[model samples]
Target chain A: MLNPTITEILLSLMQVSYITLIVLVVSAICGLILGTILTIIVVKKIPVLKQITVTFSSFTRSVPIIIQLFIVFYALPPVIESMGFSTTYITATVASIVALSLYHGGYLVEVFRAAYRALDKGQHEAADSMGYTPIQKFRRITLPQTIPVALPGWGNALIHLIHDTSLVFALGVVDIMGRGQLIAASSYGMNQVKIFLIIAAIYIVLTFLSDAIIRFFEKKNKKFKLDSGLNTKGA
Target chain B: MNFLILFEDFVQLLAVVPQTLLLAITIFILSILIGTVMALIQEYNVPVLKLIVVIVKLLLRGTPLIVLIFLMYYSLPDTVTFLSGLVGLDYNGTNIPPAIILIVAVSFTVASFQAETIRGSFLSINKGQIEAAQSLGYTPYQMFKKIIAPQALVEAIPEFSSSFLIVMKAISLGFMITVVDIFAEARLIATDNSYYVEAFFAAALMYWAISAITVTLSSKYEEYLHSRM
Candidate 1:
């Protein structure tokens, strides 16, 4: 058996990047929506909703991602079937996305909550005194300020999401890691080291690229802070 | 869901808790030792070694723990064989236990994060205090013992505990390499009974309970440190 060619490796990595990008975007959006709702429930101390949100977050955080993936993969089909829906369409990738999105939301709750709480009480009071409605206040005063503060944490969460997506291969998703497994198995386990090394290098490069992108946004957010005079005021 | 099977699965999973905890503790100790060395190298700006440490940390941080485990699983045997051959030990790589590979690989991954945590704690120490200690004619060891170690340890406790949780969690990946920890046992039980949800939930509950206990104990320890100060 021969080693996999460079093109095969690159092609597999490209597929990995593509799948990871999709998971990242979809999960990040879902997580943000879930996180924002949970933050509201917790911050406003909404009765039952707050308890459920807290419990759910803790559950997600405690379990390993792989276990969560397995749970979702196995449990979701039965759930949908019980609801009188077809379960055939729920692929490993879909389950992976659902589990990972929940995981991301679980973590982002704390991030957003911390960022939201870190906002000055004066800002809220000032908005109220200005006769601004709640929506108007949130959109104008709360969002812009909270975003710059949350940007760093959000970036860190995104990096984590990238890493977590690698576990999807365990569910038989043909991501780079899965592709490496296939290649190694095809070669009768020859060149297993080389295949894994290439995969690891690809992951490192992906992380480096994402880190640079995150830093870029962080810098941009810093400028937004300066323009809004948040720095001078030290809020 | 069959409640009886779930209860049985939970009991079966519980049997492997000691193995999981042992792996976690060993990995935590090894990683802390390795990470501190990396942190000290970076802290003191050890010339060429610092650069290597930084690069290795970057690589480790970017790569997922699962990938590291797989990489080690595949590569370590050959590397071990080559090294032993050079030393004329006539050892076979196949003799290495998968748990050892799991420990080494996971330690490298966890240690990178630990190194950053420790280095940050070291930097958190006030420069003024160090200057005061120096001007007071304190030796290096004295400065570390009297001025730096206590403060840095306190600062590091929160991050250290979180890293410990991470170490605990990472041990679950050991199942992928055939380590018969809680996760592996859970997987076996699930396969036997086809009750995936119950098996995983039991494992998750065990993990959560352990994490909660760790968190409480660490916080208590932190409080004790504070009270002594």
Candidate 2:
């Protein structure tokens, strides 16, 4: 087969990356929200559900993002297709979201659980006495507090999802790594190395930026975030 | 296809079990060994290594390990094969040297995370505990060995086992590199039977089982760690 041109390959990879941003952003939001819900489930049933939640989170958490990506991108499409749904761009978007939502949601579960655990019970009771509905109390009294608290860990998951975007190459989605692979296939002497290394560098820089943002939020919530994780006192 | 025919293929595929387990176990042992040292270096703030360690921490922490597997698969064999020819150990396909390369590549990543667990466990030892050791006239090394290491190991096992579970999930990357683990075998079956669903169902169940065992082991290890304290 003829080797594709360097510029074309790079452009294709870039195009893949452009679409990937949508996946990452959507997945980030969905994962965090779903994960928060999962956290609430665990909290409501701390004796049994808590253990199950923690176990599921840590188990999924233990798997590498790459395998999860493969399971989502390659494995799921066929499964979905067998059920009669077309899974074309779902390849990129749904796959990323599924992989990430499961993984990132796991991380968020802990963060939300920790944040809720650490909130002074007096605040909840105070809101309760004022006749606030549970939903209203969560929106005003609970969620805003948890967002700042969860930001650091959630930010880490966001960066992680970005880096993981490169793994879309498994089914040839033409993301940055896919582009690097193409570039490697095309050029001579050091061009392949240059392209791949550049992609890796971009990934690193993005993560560093994420770490900074996470730290920023962490500082904002340092008092709450630190004491949140280990404070086992009931609400 | 008849049931017996598929059953035979399943049996054949099961033969790869040893390879998968062996690869996972050896690679993890090596990774933990390397990772603990890296963790210790990061903990004690070892000289100029900290900068390198930080760079590595980011690289391992951020990059999808499958990418690392690819880099190792594509990069290492020629150099390793060439070097081995001189020593005449005759290493190739049988040993699946590429798998070892993937293992090494993965170690670098796994170690970065494991280092955090180690560092956390180490730091959790508290200042007075270290002071008590120093008061007993123990050197820093002596204190770590006689006092800190025991507690840290106990504290770390639960998390470390979880890390091991993480590494096991990572082994799915091996399929990409042609290690012929269950996933790869399943793919081959999918191709032959054109039953992508069945093959994948088999594969998913296999992965879930593997995941279940891993979770069980880690939790048990956590319980064991708790007992020692």
* Best prediction by DockQ: 1
Over 4 Å off in model 2, which ranges? A1-15, A41-99, A187-192, A220-235, B1-14, B77-96
lDDT by residue (tens digit), candidate 1, B95-196: 899999999998998899889888898899999999999999999999988999899999999888888888888888888899888878889988897888
C-alpha RMSD over true interface residues, model 2 = 3.4
Q: Predict model 2's lDDT versus the native.
A: 0.70
> Relative to the unseen true structure, what is the C-alpha lDDT of residue A107 in candidate 2, on a scale of 0 to 100?
74
lDDT of each: 0.85, 0.70
Which digits, one per residue and each the tens of the lDDT, describe model 2 over residues A102-213? 8778877877777677676777888899999999998977766666666766776687677666666665666677667666665542354345555666666767777887
Task: Give lDDT tens digits, candidate 2, residues B92-181.
Answer: 533556667668877778888878888898889989999898888999889988889888888887777667766665776777777667
Q: What is the lDDT of residue A193 in candidate 1?
A: 73
- The TM-scores of all predictions, comma-separated, are 0.95, 0.80
The residue-by-residue lDDT of candidate 1 on A41-133, one tens digit each, is 998999999999998898887778888888898889999999999988999889999999899998988888888887878889899999999
Model-by-model DockQ, in order: 0.77, 0.32
